[model samples]
Target: MTPLLELRGLGVRYKGAVAPALEGVDLDLAAGERLAIIGESGSGKSTLARAVAELLPQTVIQQGTVAWPGLDQKARNGRDIGFVFQDPASSLDPVMPVGDQVAEVAHANLDMDWRAARRLAVELLDRVRLPEPALLAQAYPHQLSGGQKQRVAIAAAIVARPRLLIADEATSALDTIVQAEIMALISALVAEDGMALLFVSHDIALAANLADRVAVFRHGRLVEQAATAELVSQPRTDYSRALLAAHLGLHA
Candidate 1:
């Protein structure tokens, strides 16, 4: 079967930066597969996510193709992709009711009517395990906890039911327990919908636990990519080994 998403010779360069944010990056995300991009801060994992989501600014120069299964060309405006940003609070609108926001995504992409969209929003909230979907729907962004906000963000992203979901450092802001819940939620959603997941995070251990495949990034390049067990058990690159060592030390 054709991969749900494919990146070929992908590169991104921002204005005023001498070095490209990403270079010669390549990836294939099959349907229903969970892939994680793991690296340190400024390692370009988020850059790659933004590029795939088409969230990067127009000023940034990009080369190569980010192809989807049905589209003749790379998708723009997130038609075939959905993105959950690292910061949920920043990603959501403070003024709008959470329900309306989710409804808007569904309305825009799925062509759902207002009533149907609102109903779908409530269902989405429930799907993400939010309590009191009706009450939460009326609440503003400030009313929700960090984890709740992230759940809402994920719900909004899933409302469109896009083929690929790009979660960029999605659980980084939540506490460990909440992070685990969010990861489990995402994993469940992926399984239920058979959607491809691109999970970008700096936490190697977490990624190893969550992803089917893990790609290690260093200075804008993918240094290693393999099955999660293989990569964690026997990392081929020195950088990969160091990352695993640091992760082990942190949890020790």
Candidate 2:
């Protein structure tokens, strides 16, 4: 079967930056498959995700193709591709009720009226395991904890039932316990909905735990990619080895 997502010679450079954030990278994610882009800061993993989602800023110069051979039409950002950014505070509207924020996506993408969209929004908040979905629906971004806000963000992302979910460092900002919770939530949702997942993170161990495959990146280039087990057990490149060693050290 055709891959749900394909990238060919993907490159991105901020207009005034000295170097490109991403360069000549190629990757793929199959339907219902979870692929993690592993890289430290400035390594371009986030750039790759944004490129695929076409979420990059207007000033950036992007090259090459992000094609969906598995779908007939080009993907739209909020409709077909759901993105959970690292910071939910910035992604969500502070003034709007969390439910309304989520409902807006469903209302816009699913073409539902506000009342119906709001009902679906509460249902989604419940699905994300938020406590007292009805009450939380009225809460604003500032009212909820970091994890709760992120949960609201997740609810918004999946409200349209998108074909793909790109989680760009979705758990990085949270505490360790909350990180695990969010990871579990993401894993369960992906499995339950069968949406292709593009998980971008610096945490090799987390990537190994959640991804079918992990693609290592460095300095805006793809260093290597392999099955999660294979990559963790026998990394091919020195960089990959170092990354694994670092993760081991952190947990040890």
Best candidate according to TM-score: 2
Across residues 57-87, which tens digit of lDDT does each residue of candidate 2 receive? 9989998899999899999988889999999
CA error at residue 80 for candidate 2, angstroms = 1.0
Candidate number achieving the greatest lDDT relative to the actual structure: 2
TM-score of each: 0.95, 0.97
Query: Candidates' lDDT values, in order?
Result: 0.89, 0.93
Clashes of each: 0, 0
Q: Residue 137 of model 1: what lDDT?
A: 97
**Which consecutive 10 residues in model 1 have the weakest lDDT in total?**
70-79
Clashing residue pairs in candidate 2 are none
